[model samples]
Target: MIVADLSSRELRRRLSDDGLYLHSGPFICRIQSVLAKVADGLALAYADYPLADADYADFHLRLAAPRLRRWISPQVQFHADVRQPFLPLPQQQAYAMFEWGLNWCVSQHANQYLILHAAVLEKNGRALVLPGHSGAGKSTLCAGLVYGGGWRLLSDELTLIRPADGLIQALPRPVSLKNASIEVIKQLAPGAIFTPTVMDTSKGSVAHAKPPSDSIVRQQECARLAWVAFPRYRAGAALNTQTVSVPQLLMRLAEQAFNYSLHGQDGFSTLLNWAQSAQAFEFEYSDLPQAIAYFEQLASQPHTQLQHEAAPV
Candidate 1:
């Protein structure tokens, strides 16, 4: 069902409380938490027109960050104070932005364990971990992996790594698709549910592609990270495989880290120990077939050559 179509007067009515609206493309998110479906969304008061010099990420970091904590509580209070009934157009518009910001928090919080920025897929008792940075074609590769490689997408953004065991946790978050990538995925997976596209985000005209039903259904069965493969998408670069230096990986990963210092020396030790057990590689490819074949081969190697992603923070 559609949530509130916010107006200045209606927004003022909710002055006593805050509300959340989730808009993704055509669909309005009816968040189903344990307490309620949040049919209209948890009552959180918001402005008719909030700050927007940047994308939803900036809004989340700036406005919502103050209300949020680095860690959440078990019975966390959601801003629930709505005065008027749900609206249509405006609610959807606001939902589109709020949804992204909240999801970003979920991902960042999960990363408290490890700095995982990749698309993850699991199937047949195996989880394929693709670790990379922005503009690395990680999302596009992920779209290909799930659509062609016959795997379940665990995440398209953050792959939360458990600090103690170095186990890669599956964070079932939405996939962020850019202009062409969105079309590419729709062509590949027609049944994929995509939210509304927000104009002029960091990557330009961004949208969120949701997780597969199979992944959602099996969300409880956490997949143990079997292999960590670093993917790189180069326009004209030939397909090549090179060993990534351990120290180099650590440093790079630390830069992307969300909470490396919070865990202190123990966090470093855990990551290092895990690196010693996994094989590290620099996967560069201009062609998709070679990239796919490369990963297929890595799947065959023994999991004895441990590697690191970013160096010690």
Candidate 2:
């Protein structure tokens, strides 16, 4: 049964009791949390995700109040299969912490695939991978594309690429918007659901936008890589898409990968395969509408011979 089948109260009860096993893309995360915000967050953001049976779970996690911290200040600790990996965070930020913690759990432990620090979305079966560091506006642009351009969301944080086939595995999770970007996206997509803002975290004023229900419903769909765009958000900058060489793209992508060296030669081969098959560009833009329009044009263009031609290593 899907999470939507359960009432928020039922979801909370399950979390407090035996835990709630919810499907997230290919993995089932069994969550047990006594913190109310954690339940609220899941109820609001993951209401549409499928709830798995207890017999099948990839990871079991919990968010609970800390012991000593209860006397000093209230805080929450995240536990994966009863093992706590993170220090306690403020009680007010429990939901944000849970979301970040889950992403960390999957990205760090799921080494079966070549994971990259990127935002991925698809349109007409063509997937675009946007890789960037913090403050790069990758999630902002991804939210814009999914809501503003009607692209399907594959993932807003981690991009999982299978080395064997070089196809991107879907992880249609929430889009995180930090600080000013939260308000920016709220205005851009008025209908989108956003968690209440939590201020003064490491990322500063963090909020998560729920992934579109259609994207979550089609989470099993995987697509081949089409374009690798390094997006930079600069104030008042005109829209520019610069062609990046394959070697440079590969080097930059390696720098942003989560487990490039973990897979060794297999990882290198996967990167090579993606670079050879997908177009690469450095995208800089100030105007969100203009940026969306530019991508629309790119998405409409058919794959060309250049996509398959090998570049100098």
- Using TM-score as the measure, the top candidate is 2
Instruction: Kindly list the per-residue Cα lDDT of model 1 for residues 218-248, writing each as its tens digit.
Output: 5445666655567888889998777766566
Report, for every candidate in turn, its global Cα lDDT versus the true structure.
0.53, 0.89
TM-score of 1: 0.64
Q: What C-alpha lDDT does candidate 2 achieve relative to the native structure?
A: 0.89
Residue 53 deviation, candidate 1, in Å?
36
For every candidate, C-alpha RMSD to the true structure in Å: 11.5, 1.4
lDDT of 1 at 221: 57
The TM-score values for the models, in the order shown, are 0.64, 0.97
Kindly give the stretch of ten consecutive residues in candidate 2 with the minimal lDDT sum: 304-313
- Report the lDDT tens digits of candidate 2 across residue range 12-99: 8999999999889999998998889998888889988988888878888889998778878799988888678888899989999888
Model 1 stretches with alpha carbons more than 4 Å out: 1-96, 107-112, 300-313
